[model samples]
Target chain A: MIWVAAALLFWGMAWALNAWLARSRHSGLRAVRIAVPVIFGLTILVVWELLVRGLNVPLVILPPPTMIAATFGGNLAILWEDFVQTFLKGALSGYLIGCGAAVALAILIDRSPFLQKGLLPVGNFIAALPIIGTAPILVMWFGFDWQSKAAVVVVMVFFPMLVNTVQGLAASSAMQRDLMATYSASYWQTLLKLRLPAAMPFIFNGLKIASTLALIGAIVAEFFGSPVRGMGFRISTSVGQLALDMVWAEITVAALAGTLFYGTVALVERGVTFWHPSQRK
Target chain B: MNRILPILSVVTAIIAFWYAAVVPMNIHGVLDQAERDGVVVVPGTAKARRDFASLGLVMLNPGQAAKSWMQERPRLPAPHQVAIELWQTTVEKKVTSKRSLVFHAWVTLSATLLGFAIGTGLGVLLAVGIVHNKAMDMSVMPWAIASQTIPILAIAPMVIVVLNSIGIQGLVPKAIISAYLSFFPVVVGMVAGLRSPDAMQLDLLKTYHASRAATFWKLRLPASMPYLFTSLKVGIAASLVGAIVGELPTGAVRGLGARLLTGSYYGQTVQIWSALMMAAICAAVLVGLIGLAQRLILQRMGMTGR
Candidate 1:
């Protein structure tokens, strides 16, 4: 019961403090606002620890934060292996291939009206195919290796990247194209100079989106069938073993990877799209 | 005029290639025994003898050389064979039959919808909390982004078991796993949406002496509608993924995950393929439905996107 109280109290205080921080006018006050959530998170963790101890909540259901931290510390090796297999071997490889291919295809499709309608629909249809159902089949065909995971990632990231690139390539208005045309700039020169630059923001949007999709695809693909060392395999096996702390640890690793990946993409976007009105702030 | 013919030709060429690939089934001759220089070859010897074409013909015709093709059928079942199997097993049998994939799909669908609702609700509530607080904005935003890096696929089963030990049995735990996987996207999208109103809009509302609540409803809420719907559309797909991931840990007997497992275990490739196709269809329909809803909502609000 006290655990419940702590959770409620912590959440309530966090909520109140966070609201004030959001409304703060001063830039310094804004900085303080950022800590509000962290404090809230810490408070909840403390309450969770206290309440779990006080109320005797089962570790299986809600392991105290400390236990999770300890478990994470203890199982660094397994977590590290899973990270390499899923992130480096599977998601990253697929992200590169899928995004690269999509961009190339987007350029081709842009040059041809025939491809715009015919190819886009096919891309759309394939994109809509759920990875959960396809991963196992792909694993069977590609064998129980990272190749299959890459295939699944390819399938997952393809559409979003394709759609965005196509949109990006189209972003340069007809007026811009006319200007290039009047300059007698060769088609290749114009494309390299104007269209590609104009398309960078849109391309980056697709890349950012693909990062998430690639991560998701790699992890989900592992659920179907993977070598013994991948994150997916450990996650699946640990459940039967009832290793909640280890699972949380792996989760922490994955969460860290996802955040870093997302942050990198955002940072790149800020650099590349600085001229865009959205980035002016 | 220039484009249409090229597209038609491409389609025609693909179909022609498909037919040509299938026609090789007729070239059947068993090399069970072979004689290099007209010497009589024993059945068990390196030399093999058999009417391979007859076997291929029998397999293809299923009557002309049935005996020969029986040995050759595994390479690829004839289209008719698969078609017959599809009809007899999927169409003729009722969904309640033990053979039905629909029954399994229903199990997966149940978990998906259950988890989706829970995740979406939690996400909205969290977004609300994060948006209303400054400290939360700073701490929670980064944490939320970080939360996603940890692959849910790896933790879904663990979530299931952990929840199971806590006396949260059956669907709820699985739903929680799904919700855990899905909630992040919704929260992120909603937070972005909630903060979408420009300072000018806020200032305008202030000029009217509007309270925070009034400003939120009159300006921010309306502005964020499109963003929220887009996120919800994305969330629904994520939820389906969550539900599917939820099944891997428990190996529940009646869901699509179970079907995939059982099919793989038994090498029922056709069954596995069809189930996958069905899941793909289901996802498409779910996403399409949300898109339709988005269109309706936007149109109702007098916001039209070409």
Candidate 2:
């Protein structure tokens, strides 16, 4: 009861503080902007910890964040293995291959307006479909290993990457192309100098999207079948064993890995597309 | 009409490619079966044949290669085989039958629709709160954006199992997963939508002495329609995927995910292919319906471009 009251008081205080900070002139400062959300998140975690302890919620149902942290700390090696199998060996390899192929195909088809028109809609349609359904088929074909997970990631990322690259290649305006023509620039020169650089923003946008999809595809494909070492395998098995702490630990690894992966891609995008309007500010 | 020819040609080319690739994909198995039937197989030994490329096997036994498409469980089922299976399960079986793809699809669709509605409602409400309250905008918006980077689907099995242990079974658990999956996109989109009314438009409302409610109803909601529809399309597709994946940990009991699982377990590649086709069709139709709704609502409000 004391814990609950203390939690409630803390939550109320944090809410008031955030509200005050948001309305204050200093809220425009980067520090205040960052602090508000951090405070908010901490408040939730505090409240969750207190409430679960005060109410005596079963560990099997919802393990406390502290317990999850402990489990995460204790099982670093296992988590790292899962991470490499799913994220590095499966998702990363597939992301590179899929995006590379899409960019290559986009460039190859850029010369033909007819092919572009034909393929764009098809790619868009495929992108919106539940392509994850192919996971089981791919798993069967590639066997229950990291290879199958990689294959799933490849198919999942391919269409989105293709569509984005194709759009990116067309980002250069007609006037820019005409200027290249006036300079007697060969198609290859113009493509290399003007078009590919212009396409960086769009390509990066696709990469960022595919980064998320790659993680998701690799993990979900493991649900269909895996070699007993991937994140999905651990998650499903832990749940059945009612090892909610282990499940949460794996989830923590996944969340951290996903955020880092996406952040890396965005950071690279910032460097590569520094002159793009969206990146400039 | 001009675009139609290109699209048709592209589709035809894909189907042709799929058909051509099936023989090579399934040839090793096809040749193994032919050799079991005492047919002469090139390279003479199964051991030698195993090391040879699948395309070489296809070339060595052209007569047996056609049997790849007719195999009971080919590695890659032919497109027409999938189409036929889809037709048989959807059209031939009774809708109430467990074997019916229509029944399975309905099981999945209900959860998707229910979750979509809940998610869209919650997302809109949260967006409104974020937009109106400076505290929420500062505190919640960043986390909401960051949450999208996390693969939330990783928790689907855990969610289902936990909910089941708590005595909440069937569609609600699945719907909850779907809701969680679809929630972020709608929130982000709707936030952008509600704030889309330019400063000039807000100033006009202020000058007219419009109340906050009046301004919201008359201006903000209308401006948000385009963004709302775009997110809804994305949200619905996500919801459907969530529902299907949610079915997986339920142990091959029902839904499209079950079909995929059971097919894989039994090595029924044809069944898996048909389920995939059904899922694709469902996604297309759901997205198309949202698009149609967008057109109708936007047109009725005179929001369409002249």
Candidate 3:
């Protein structure tokens, strides 16, 4: 009860402080802009900790963030194995294979108007097939290893990459293609020098999208079948065991991995598409 | 019709590819059966025979190649097998039957629509708050963006478990997970939509001495319609995925997710493929409905150019 009171008090104070900060002229300043959300995040964490502890919430229902951190620290080796199994072996390999294949297919389709017209819709249909449905089927096909997980990730990432690359290839205007024609450039040279460069921003958008999708596919695929060492396997088992802290710990790793995966893709995108209008901003 | 000819040809090409793939994918199993039956065309080891990939070798044993397409638990079920299963479950059986695809589809679709409603409502409300209240913009908007970075698959089970413990079960729990997935798109879209009113437009409103409420009703809300519908299409599709994911963790004996799980468990590849087809079709229907509604509403509003 006291904890609840303290939480309410803290929330009220935080609300007042944030409101004041938001209204102030200096709120437009960069530091203040960052500070508001940071402070807001801290306040919520504190409130959650206090309420859960003070209210004596069951550990299974909601493990405190500190408990999650402690579990993460204590189970480094297991976590690391799970991370490698799911992220590095499954997601990364699948992402590379899928994205590579998609880009190749996209380029091939771009060369033929017939292929583009027919294939894009078909791709969209396949993309709409839910990951849950595919994961189980892929697991059955490839066996209960990271191979199956990779297969799921491959399916999940493929269409988006293909669609984006296809769109990106078309980003080069007809006039620009004609310019290359005037220069007597061959198809391959025009593709390499003009089309591919023009396509970078769109391709990177797809990559950024796929990075998170790959992580998700890898993790979710494990819920179907895995060799006792993957994030999804650990998460499901821990939940069944009522080890909420362990589940939270795995979630933290997943969140961090997802953020880092997306960030890396975005960073690479920035480097590659530096001249694109969106990147310039 | 011209547009459809290419699509038909592409689909026909894919079906042909799928049929061809079935032979190679199921060859090992077929050969294992042949070895068990003591049909030794190859005198060497089973490994050598299995590793060998020649269409000519498969063609030599027409019966065995045919058997690959008809395997009870094939690595890849033929399209006809899946189509037949889909027809049987969806049309032949009673909709109330657990074996029926319609029943499982309903279980998923109910959660999806409910969650989409809850998500769209919450998203619009939050977006409105963020746009109007500077404090919410500062505090809630960043958190909303951060929330999406956390993968929904990792969180679905936790949400289900937590909600289960509190005596919130079945449709509501699944709907919450669906809402979690769908809400982000709506929020992002609505925020962009609401703020789309330019400074010049705001000044024009100010010249009329319009109240905040009036400006919102007359301008901002209408401006957000196209964006809202666009996000709703994405959100509805996402919500279906979420409902399926939520079903997976619980191992619920109902829903398309359940059908996939049960099929995989029993090695009923045809059933699994049928469930997948059902899910894809559901998504298409949902998105189509949203698109139809968008057109109707926009036309009614005299925003057909948009």
Tell me, by TM-score, which candidate is best: 2
Cα lDDT, all candidates: 0.73, 0.93, 0.88
**Candidate order, DockQ descending:** 2, 3, 1
The DockQ scores of all candidates, in the order shown, are 0.43, 0.88, 0.71
Stretches of candidate 3 off by over 4 Å are B32-63
Give the 10-residue window scoring lowest on summed lDDT in candidate 2 chain A.
A272-281
TM-score of chain A of each: 0.91, 0.98, 0.96
Residue-level lDDT tens digits of model 2 in A186-269:
999999999999999999999999999999999999998898798999999999999999999999999999999999999998
- Which CAPRI category fits model 1? acceptable
- Which lDDT tens digits does candidate 1 get at residues A1-281? 66577677776876676666655665266557457657767876887787777778766666778998998988888788889999999989989898988888888778887767666556655665666566776777688889999988887888889988887888999999999999999989988999999999989988887887788888877777788988777777776676767677777778788878888998989998889888996
Interface RMSD of 1: 3.7
Q: If scored against the real structure, what TM-score would every candidate get?
A: 0.82, 0.99, 0.96
Ranking by lDDT: 2, 3, 1
Docking category of candidate 3: medium
Which digits, one per residue and each the tens of the lDDT, describe model 2 over residues B1-306? 789888898999999999999999998888888889999989778899989999888888888877988888899999989989999999999999999999999999999999999999999999999989999999999999999999999999999999999999889999999999899999999999999999999999999999999999999999999999999999999999999999998784889999999999999999999999999999999999999999999999999822
**Model 1, position B265: C-alpha lDDT score:** 63
Stretches of model 2 off by over 4 angstroms after superposition: none
